[model samples]
Target: MPFVWAPIPFPDTNRIDMALTDKRRNWTPEEDVVLLTQVAADLPFAADKGQVTKSWQSLADKLVACDHFDRVVDGRKVQNMFTALVDEHRKFDMASAKLSGVDQEELEKHTLLDELLPLLDEVKS
Candidate 1:
């Protein structure tokens, strides 16, 4: 089920508190794919403009549109998730690069995260 952000009513008050009532859930693999795809699409724009938050917000909107995630995702959440993914991929890429006999053509990337490495490298250059 998708997470809903309902306002909590204050007792005897006319105000409603707009805080997240449920704990945040982990990103699913499907959601990650959506996010990565969206990021890849926006890479050139982001590289030229350097507006990461706007790019992340666009990614969040695209992910939410996919309706694959359990909870509502915001730009900040998307940014954090992408940051974590990039960090993990960096470590993985470094370890893989250090391997002596592994040919680039022989390396297999079965996940969206793995596929994102080269695109990220492009943005850096």
Candidate 2:
């Protein structure tokens, strides 16, 4: 006898709110570089109290105006993405610090991250 598979019925009324919301897409490397550059350029605005949202919205608008991406994003989305990037950078920086005798050449490879480091430090202070 062959085994039979049955499809489960999903009710429309019980649908999750997430399904109705916009689907998230992954940011490309180019997009990441562009975002980081934009953020670094506007670090002062970002550090200013109560101007973070406006800064992010400005970044989003700049990104959209670049005519590189097909999908549109809002300030919140850009902020979240920047947060994730910063988190990753923190983790990587911490790990690198733990390692002994890392070559200067290797460390210098992450030029973009290095450039943003001073801006981030300034923001913290």
User: In model 1, what are the clashing residue pairs, if there are any?
Assistant: none
In terms of TM-score, the best-performing candidate is 2
Task: Residues 92-118, candidate 1: write the lDDT tens digits.
Answer: 778887987876542222266666667
Query: Compared with the true structure, what per-residue lDDT tens digits does model 2 show for residues 5-122?
Result: 9998887753555455435557777777777777777763345688878878887888788776544777888788777887787888788889869764543225667777777777
Query: Candidate 1, after superposition: displacement of residue 30 in Å?
Result: 2.4
Q: Estimate each model's TM-score.
A: 0.59, 0.66
lDDT scores in order: 0.66, 0.71
What TM-score, to 2 decimals, does candidate 2 have? 0.66
- Model 1 whole-model lDDT (C-alpha atoms): 0.66
Lowest lDDT 10-mer window, candidate 2?
103-112
lDDT of 2: 0.71
Query: Per-candidate RMSD vs. true structure?
Result: 10.5, 7.7
